[model samples]
Target: MSTSPQKRKADDLDIELDLDEYVPYVPIKQRREAKFQKLASQRNIPEPQKENEPDDETEELVRAGPKANISLIDQAVEVKKQKLIEDSSKTDIEKKLEEEKAIMEAVAQRKLLASVQELAKGIIYTEPMKTTWRPPRHIRERAQADHDAIRQRYHILVEGEDTPPPIKHFRDMKFPSAILKYLKYKGIHRPTPIQVQGLPVVLAGRDMIGIAFTGSGKTLAFSLPLVMFALEEECKFPLIRGEGPIGMIVCPSRELARQTYEGISSMIDFLVRDGYPKLRHLLCIGGISMSDQQNVLSEGIHIVVATPGRLMDMLEKKKFNLDLCKYLCLDEADRMIDMGFEDDVRNIMSYFTSQRQTLLYSATMPKKIQDFARSALVKPVIVNVGRAGAANLDVIQEVEYVKQEAKIVYLLECLQKTPPPVLIFAENKNDVDDIHEYLLVKGVEAVAIHGGKSQEEREFAIRAFKEYKKDVLVASDVASKGLDFPDIQHVINYDMPKEIENYVHRIGRTGRSGKTGVATTFINMNCSEQILLDLKHLLREAKQRVPPVLEALEDPTEKFKDLSGGCMFCGGLGHRISECPKLDAQRRQQLGNISRGGGGAERGGGEY
Candidate 1:
């Protein structure tokens, strides 16, 4: 709307009032004109007056400058050159990666040097472990050569893709520092064949079936990996009793379970240092208070070393759960089957998750064990340290053909031959008690253990034997397998074992850890004929001297041959019919008759 001059002045005054907080309202064209006017005034230059031209249609717009001629390719090339110059400089990320690599290499060198120093000081077993970070050609070649030698020596047979090389020494493996220290403290320098081979597979997170001799350190092989796995899991998730153990080791016998628990617990204790968490382990076995075990479970355990029956009992009672279990190890799996723990093991396995790792270790791989492995393990690698059913080669076996009644006498003779620390294995508890009592009466220090004995008594007997307080430990098949007695110089088989595997395990009680030992068996007709052929084959394979009595049993017809043929009355083998007990009795009667006739003739006739 048109306004008077006075009204426009009033509007301008209103617009100029308090412009500090005012939002700009003037349009761009008017602002630019005012800016030009202010600039001309500041520079004291005359303003270019707008020309008073009539509104004509023909008005020309003027250009400020001319455009330069340029091609797209040259412009792109120039831009690329600048980009290359910028890229030639190192970025912050690249610098950081280089620093990290150097730091890692330095750490590796320090670790290697520490290992070598320990070896030099006779702390750890063997030399420093070869480093894979910057492996030299010579180092790799030497490692390969050592691995081949170990394989050849142990007769190791492996079946798996990407099977790691066997460890020659404990240091060759990447165990936690706690384990190495424990080994050093225990004077275990070299890794046994089973430990060397089986540990790598288990540590690599693969299911494995390990076959090795009884005393070949299979326990530690599985235990070490189990500790590492539990530690790794504990770091990821907090342990709770309701979730059960992250790792579980099932053994056949209570002794084996306790032994395994002790081994694992010692290492776990060592692992609980400044920066590491405390690892809790429980031994769930029979003959112990169930309430006590329940208390342990309530507190929570990272690992559970259990016997099949006891583990099943715990499961049934809802004492623990296995749905979150990550590792399942069956030590002496074949023995477990023989002990009839297959059903319990399977039932316990049902509680575990399907994604668990399984490890089955046995001295001998029987058909039952093989079947179980096929069902339980997922593409397991079989690691055979030696031939199945083969006895320890270091035992010097000698058989004596004695009557079953004379076993005690023969045992005394064996004691005379060897020094202290003798293990006497009998067939039954009665025989063990009898022998133990006889030895005690003979002023010989002895102890006895059988399945019938209370657990406390058995443990006491074992302790006595281990401490050298008792020179002789008479036992049944209960101590035949998985008991480690390092100082046993002789194993006397007072009563031959019924099973061939039991016989092997009985003799295996000696000649452990590459030490030479003597095993003497007293054979009678009852057991000799039955086990003669098997014994002969075993002795021959072990490079032992087979007695002629056993060698004679090689004939298939001799399976029923009686080796104890002798006189039934006098128990003598070389006697004629005329000299038998019946003939002697008749002769004595005739002599009596003659004596009586002489006496009557002298008394009645007086002169004859």
Candidate 2:
């Protein structure tokens, strides 16, 4: 054991090393010693040298390898071998990353042209959508019956796909079948309209603009594609972790950001259940503690869900890095801009390279949003489920002029029979509160949500409204754009919106899910002619009937419901004279005949 030259030959070569491909900081002299150590380790040299030997192998693995400074030729040759081994590992990491970058290059470049090229893809409801010409009652029923049959047949025959183009390079990807099996188990055997179309373009690293109404599966559309890329590349991110952005998903509000995070978590759970277990993500939003989010980042995370302001705040604090990001998504893009987040968006995006894939989605895109999109996202695929003019065309439009004083009674009248769950919009916080209180006192299930509410309260209100604990949600404009209430069957403009665009958001809440919705605006007598003019213009743009009567009413006031008058029978304010105890019996007796529709009454129920 003392020293057989033959026995010592292999021991002389064993070494240990670990390397990263991107770092070029490793020096040259000690590289030979690394080679010898690697050779010895590979040959399993025994512990004759192990007793007092330092654990240099474990200590030096992440940094410069053993023999990093050794200059002797014999050790250098061993070190050279170690360096080669380290370099090879680095080379493998580099080669794999390069192939990913290369494979993704075409996708990245396509993003350069995606916006214009993808604008026309999902044109499901164009002029033809408007060609129904208000089918007659019988014809409508018959048409609906026919369509229902077709839809049911289609649902059964196909898994709601549009001949999904097979994934390119499917064999090259090392997908965990258990994940696929899990999806299959859940009958998610096929992707939805948005997913089937958006995934390929995203996987190719192209930017996309997703436009679909609520519940059309927009969340899964982008999330699945993101997962696909992360899994295929085994994306490096530190969660609770390391430094650098692997991905960022920006939503308009904390509510939406949290929703997206929860969804991604479930997807990860699903994948894990099927045998492919390792998946990591993060959630960042306005109300959450920055330190908590930063700690998660310290560990490194693969996916992050955040709103623009909070994400930017974290970015400024150096809690997250966007320079290394390969993917970026903007959910409810239009709403984000409306919330005055343009500056923050550009600031957060500035940290990302131009080569990153950017996916932006909204229910509707205005010119303002489009202009911002111009500077924000690269040429992105615009997957519009419906365009500006055609948005919510499936929804029906209605308007009713009511006296300011009679509004409550009229609302109660409207609600008396067959009341539908409604979204009532008001111009101010005061209005939201007043209207909300009235509804609650009237025994209607209702909740109020606005900027004044705490984040927790706001979230609770939203959940309560969604779960039907409340059938109506009285809110200010804050609830308009970012919300998606697919079951809202009616939207009432409790107060005529000051801006016409606000009216659009108000009514857009209803008539979701391709269901015909009813929106009634209580055009008060006080609304200015210009306000009326604006309403007309917007209605024209939306291509719906603007009530010939509303146009005809001058200084424009004809109350739709005449519920505010004195009790006509008795001529008592807010009550019938017969019901008023203040009246003398003789007076009551004298007016009794007239009040009861026996003497002074006119025909057709318009008597006084």
Candidate 3:
């Protein structure tokens, strides 16, 4: 087939093919073979084969070639054998048998070598190594205690008639063997608290609102249910494009949508290999060709992970239908609401049946999110892993009351001190770009991402940052939420965010997956008062040291000593201005001058 541009040109040129003649149309394969043979003949590569070679000609050649030379007959025989070996008519079973024989031979040779080594070492036999080790009784007891403490600490509220029990281990749950194998392959032995608690609620097909910190495995908590549901349907019926997708994941941003897609896609491949129905998924985001997305939708998909805007676009374009969607997940719902995607999300949800199982996952649940959940979900089990606005306990927060002009200096000092892979978040795109350029000028490997950047540039920046090709990533709030970036050692707030919740999200970028990380914020009195108060409270909750300025801002009464009159010079408000010693020397000098001037300029020394 011609390329699209070529086809368009042909259409514009009014080209037509005439099929009236009896000229036999040649297959593309035969035409290409003929063309290549002509080229080979030109190059004198054994003169090309003729199209109409008589069968009797080969017999005549065999009878006469022996008279010419005996080696020619041997050559012909060898060529015939090679042609037979290369024949396309070979059965798949024959190929499989050959591969199996080769593999068995290799295994036997390895075994023989190992046995020879054992004999040379004078060893009679060897026992297999133990690959599994159970935790000691004390360790289990401690872990149980910790789990109980965690459950007690977090305000995990559930309202359901029959809630499934929390799983102690992934193996204890009745997940498919494929999922279990994937877990083992990923070396995820222990489940996070959110997973332990939320998995059962979701697997039971209950509407759930899971509030967990970033990188706490909430993706898996919700994704596993979608995957399991798809798997269950796979055993019952074949899922085709005509049926639309079985699961739909909506995230606020394209990066987050891609992250969720990747998380679910990994399991899809494994499940398909483990005898499940072939699963197909598509990422629906803007900043790409709509025609390409429409093409994919025409082919059908089993799962659609998309940002809200692009999904709405596709829905309006009639690219795909959601009638068959059984699982609906809204990841980072709070962020979606914050980014003003609530209407889009609501509109998209309207396309699906109200009976579809809904799962909303967010890091924090403000009143807006709570109301959104109530309106969209049905009796969702509100699972709060920690305090709603609390920063991750794994992050060590440091605050400095730096002047606005000196922020860059402080940032540079921090970059010099901290390890690589630092993330610097700014409040706006201009700041992000400025910091990125400044870092580059200073020879720091830095990349930037923001709404101002093109989609390709943003993707490249994200990729570079993730791969450590760039050590520092300067970004606006776009990178602060939902995106799963790993091994970020430090997060520096070059400019304090306007919202307290955003502060939590920015620092939450680091200190993820139970890893300890550092977050440094350059704050000044010029920052918003509400953010200052919120930062103080958050720092106190996280058990970090609060600066005196922040503490004073948090509680003005405690820092207040006296509000009475003070020395005008020092402005201490601790002494009267008249008795202030700062004026004594000036008064003495004035009196001496007046005396020397014969009292003509005698000063009124009452207040002097």
In the range 1-608, model 1's lDDT, one tens digit per residue, is 89999999998888789675678789987788789899979998444445675332312111111232445566678679887786679674454445545533442231121122333454422222111222234434666668678788878878765566676666656666777888887779888888777877787777778888867888888888878877877787867657658889887777777778888878877788535788878888778876766666676778998877778878888788876677888887766543235445556766754357778887766533455455556566788876766788888888888887787866777799889999999998888999999999989999998888887898899888989999999998878767889889899988667556678888988988889889898887887453566677677777888888876654442332343222222212222122234224434654666788732111110000
Best by TM-score: 1
Q: Go through the candidates in order and give each one's C-alpha lDDT.
A: 0.70, 0.58, 0.69
Each candidate structure's TM-score, on Cα atoms with residue i matched to residue i, is 0.67, 0.56, 0.65
Model 2 ranges with Cα > 4 A deviation? 1-196, 212-216, 235-240, 290-295, 335-339, 416-420, 526-544, 549-608
Q: Which ten residues in a row are the worst by lDDT in model 3?
A: 599-608
Q: What is the C-alpha RMSD of each candidate to the true structure, in Å?
A: 32.5, 30.6, 36.3
Q: What is the RMSD of candidate 3?
A: 36.3
What's the residue-level lDDT of 319 in candidate 2? 73
Give me the displacement of residue 94 in model 2, in angstroms: 59
lDDT, model 1, position 549: 82
List ranges where model 3 is wrong by over 4 Å.
1-150, 153-160, 290-296, 554-608
Per-residue lDDT of 73-166 in model 2, one digit per residue for the tens?
A: 6565876898788777765436544543453343122221222212335211111101111223443355544633533432311122221222
By lDDT, the better pick of 1 and 2 is: 1
- What order do candidates take by TM-score, descending? 1, 3, 2
Instruction: Report the Cα lDDT for residue 424, model 3.
Output: 95
TM-score of 1: 0.67
**How many pairs of residues in model 2 come into backbone collision?**
39
